[model samples]
Target: MSWRRALKDTARSGIAVEKKRLEPLIAVRGAAGLAIVIALSLWLFGPAAAASSAFGAFQAAIATFQRSWRPRPELAIASGTSLAVSTFLGYLTISKEPLFLALLVVWAFAAGMSWAAGPTIGLIASSNVAIMLVTVTLPTSVAQAAGHAAMMIVGGLVQAALIVLFPVRRWGAHRDALADALAAEADYARRLRHDPVASFDPQPLMEARNAAAVTPRQARRRPAELHGARGIAERIRPVLASLADPAMGVPAEGPARDRVRELLASAAALLDAAAHAIRHGEPVSTPPAALATFRTPDTGSILTGAPYRAMTRLNTLLQDVVETAGGAPQESALQGGAPKGRGELRDQPQPTRTRPRTAPHHPPRRRPTFLALIPKALKAMRSELHRGSPITRHATRVSAVAATGYILGTWLPLGHGYWAPLTSVMVMRPDFSQTYSRAVARLAGTVIGVAVATGVVQAATPGTLQSGTLAVASAALMYLLMRTGQFATQACIAAYVVFLLGMGGEEWTQTVPERVLLTLMGGFLAMLAYAVYPAWETPRLRTRLADWLAAQGPYAAAVFGSYADPSASNAPDVRGALLTARTARAAWHAAVARATAEPVRHRGLSRTAADDAEDALAQLGRVAMLLEAHLPERGATPVPPAARFADALRESTHKGAKAIRERRVPTWDAVREALDAWETEDTDKVLRNTATLVLDTLTELSEALDTAVPPMTLDGTAPEKPDGPRNPKDSATR
Candidate 1:
């Protein structure tokens, strides 16, 4: 070969060799994973003679996986791999002696159990091992030990397969849950559109909404608030770096970042409010009045409040997610044909109603009695209880059912079967709906671990002392695995150890098929139990949205009212409002979770409504900030004509009433035209125009609801601007 060609060929060969070298490391980890499967199976299902040994290896693998997966600086996958290999090697070394093999299995079982249980398991496993060590069982001939080990190896391999194949069906269901909950929240928010200032109590309904939205997400992904914290460092670094720019000179960038940070900090405070609303069963305060000043702080100081603190953390988290997702692309126009200009509001399409204009002015006259309102309120409260929270009475009931199943499997006559024990644990876990995959993992891991254990036992010595020491080491390994958080690894290690010790001359292969059958049976039983109680997820989402929407009006009004007068400390009242917004948002999240739990149902209900509600609340918040900034200059603008104000207020009240009933908004165009004109009027004319527009709109909306008209699209006309006076609707003069 030419020299140049030789060097290139040699380099290629070197790369290939390195690649080949890494293959064994990967294989070793997989093998170790198998070892864990074997371990757990052996302990849970092994014949009395071999059970302890299998338990030891199983325990060791669990501890190793736990240590590996803990929230730390280590790469979880790598740590788990390393520990698995260490365990397999440990088994190999102990395989050579009869005493060692026996002790190894016992220790392995204990360790595996410990790892599965965590630190608490370690203490229990250790104590158990100590007792077992102090009390040795029948002495085994080398041939007898070999036979036992071989059988155990088989069992381990079978279980290993099952462990590796566990599937995640909950993820998709969770997504659906979110979508539905969002729809419900949107429905609730729609009711608040007319009530600009009436405070809507979040109460029980808000909590339901948050539960519906957030629960499914929680089940699907780690909370951004929790896992998102790490990315904060990477996020702030670039911002800080920009501030350090020589051309920029002074660190002016800090102010902008701080403001963003402050906004997030305020989020935490809002969360607190959400929690309070849930606890108190009332509408939360509005966000606008709550967060106006922080939008433009006098001193760039970190403000403290649960909402603010939460926001700060979330901001850091979101920034990290945004960065990882390749940082926010240059702010493109908002999605879905939103107007490019900043001031345009998309006019929702008006409903074409044939209802007569001469319809009586009073709302189909609600019988004005507290007794009449009581039934409506009670109904709303019930809806809130069911649909608003993610962790509902239904979830609790499910958990109880699972616990009962465990007890039944444990206490029943069939409890002695390997299947019964395994089923008790596997079936109760919320994630067990995907049985097909978990069954596969259990089988695969079992086979691999059993095969390795059989081979190790065929070449060893025979002494109790060595066996006891191996047992202790296995216990320690199990402790570590339990800490690492990988059940498969823990199970595999355990099975291998039990099988190896059982390797003696007694024929044991015959039981292999039986063990597999039992395991499958246990898993199937659990899945069946989970589906039987079937909780309805929709109510929770709807309830939460209703509760939060109820609070929006009053919150907006208070903040606007407070901002109108500077001598008054808007801070305390605004803080209270911020707390309420937080509560409402949380409820909205819960509702999303409840709605989307079922994909088919969720897709039927778009998230746009909920999004609109959130947007409206946010907009109100912006208005509060604007009013706070400009209120002193404006002075409480003159109250508009009482008729107009009364009309709007009445309309808002009707919307609130409709929302409490969980009714969808009806379509209306004449009212829409009148409202459009009112929206553009100056502050001095707002009350009158809004009132007039609201009165007409409310009458129309109530009529539309009676007919059950579904709103589909926006009116498509340009939204009226708030800066200038606009012509009043010709119909309004009537």
Candidate 2:
């Protein structure tokens, strides 16, 4: 990308506001917590103490707004505690500029390194750095600062208590995640009606899976309707894909294909209805025509053979989804006693739709409890401490910028030296686009926010009470507009900070010019820091791609191994491998997105190769998913030949990954040879067919990942001739 294009893109991203629904009630809950803390502080302490204390509630509220899976109260408490510690430590060094500056650098580095843990931690940590600036400069004794820090902890507890007592749309995030997954499937099914090979993004399903992994406390209170639905949705995806693909089940154009299209449309409507019902906790109200379309779908002659069976299986699963959405009848009603309104299935008279659903693919995987995950998070941070890691690079860059911005802010005669480093700390991120874009957004927002508040304060010269009131209003707006855009939220934040300073006895007229100028200097410093010491993703595309390829091998092998020995089936093991592969694939996708925005050369993978490799790998994963949907029963006869193929696949892909990293054309000789050997022996037809599909997809993956500079070997020797393709689409009917 050119510098002009990069700048334009970042500007547009910085300016864009999401068209999402305004979550006013949720914001009000957070603001109400802020309001309580402010009133209490003003009454008990003074305007200056109130200024220092309000940030605790303010930050605690912001933590609740993060899209985290942890409990809200936990998030609030953790954020507040982190801020209190930073505030106390920051105050101890305020009398000495050199000491505070060194501490700022170390703090900024830790904040940047926290990204390896997760975005939530990283965001809160970064805010702590920026908040540390203002808190340290409040001209208070160490004892007084400790009191203020204690007050911050109280703010957190108060916020947590409010959250526990006045819950708004409880389990609402989980509901939306599940609903979004269902809605995505609905859209995919509809698209398949016209384009059978149409692509689907699995992010929503991944998020749903994440949301479903609840703590022990959460599991007990979980809504009954949400229990089994996500598993059903996961299973539905591959079945939908396998049923629609022309090569797998349906004909290109015929009466049967038209029947398939009808089934697709019906499935879409049913899914959409289920999604809506689940999202709003309402009874399922599917269209009558959609229900009728499932009538005799398989029994009719319109679909036959595999397509027919797939259609039948789909109708059965659709019933399960609808039933789950509409919910079961009350226990009392089921026993022919008194009726209850909740948990009643609507439109439940279809006696023919009674086909049994398979048990959920596997029990939901257990996510670690919040307390238990800390050690793991710390381990991850430790891993990222090396020089090669982007997190480390980002940490180094941000820390340097913070120290430099602070010195320059103070030396340049700005009375509020903290504003510069604070701006730099808040705007800088781990990647190029975010760091640049947020710099632009934050500066613009601060200008507008500070100017508006400055005008009001200068005009009216509001006293302590009025200034506190105005600050609270700004904080409320900050909460309300946080998600709409960075620009809007930062605007409110700037105005809020202005009112806070006014409450703290700072003169409005003297601060306006310093605020805007220092903010600009800070933003410029952040952007410059990134440009000088960049960590571009373009160079690591090959490494990311290889990592994904390596992960995919084990996932496919696990599925194949299960078929080879049904009695020793490792469903959980396969699930774990599948999750690892998904993480690797998601990492590759994210790397590519970030790399594309960078003004750096593509180091290892060209654009065309990356796209092709991505598609081929997605197809491979989809094939594996389809096979997983129909694993053999525990006592079923095993396909012995599959075990050999699985071993060969596992070996070939691992070597191929090395070849990929060495910039050589990856060869799949082992895979091809194994396929030839398998063809010599007769096997169970379905197992043979699925195995061939897997092998063929891997071959496509090999061809899609080509490099032109030179051919090299994993051991630094010359390469051998690439293996010829033996398409499995031929062994079976195409």
The TM-score leader among the candidates is 2
- lDDT against true structure, model 2: 0.81
Model 1 Cα lDDT, one tens digit per residue, 60-111: 3333232111211112222233223323433344334454334434443333
Residue 423 C-alpha lDDT in model 1 = 35
RMSD of each: 21.2, 5.5
Candidate 2 residue-wise lDDT, 56-130, digit = tens? 899999999998877899889988888999999989987888898888989999999999999999999999999
Q: Which stretches of candidate 2 lie above 4 Å from their native place?
A: 297-305, 329-369, 684-690, 711-733
Instruction: Please give the RMSD of candidate 2 to the true structure.
Output: 5.5
Q: How far is candidate 1 from the true structure (C-alpha RMSD, Å)?
A: 21.2
The window of 10 residues in a row where model 1 has the poorest summed lDDT is: 330-339
Q: TM per model?
A: 0.36, 0.92
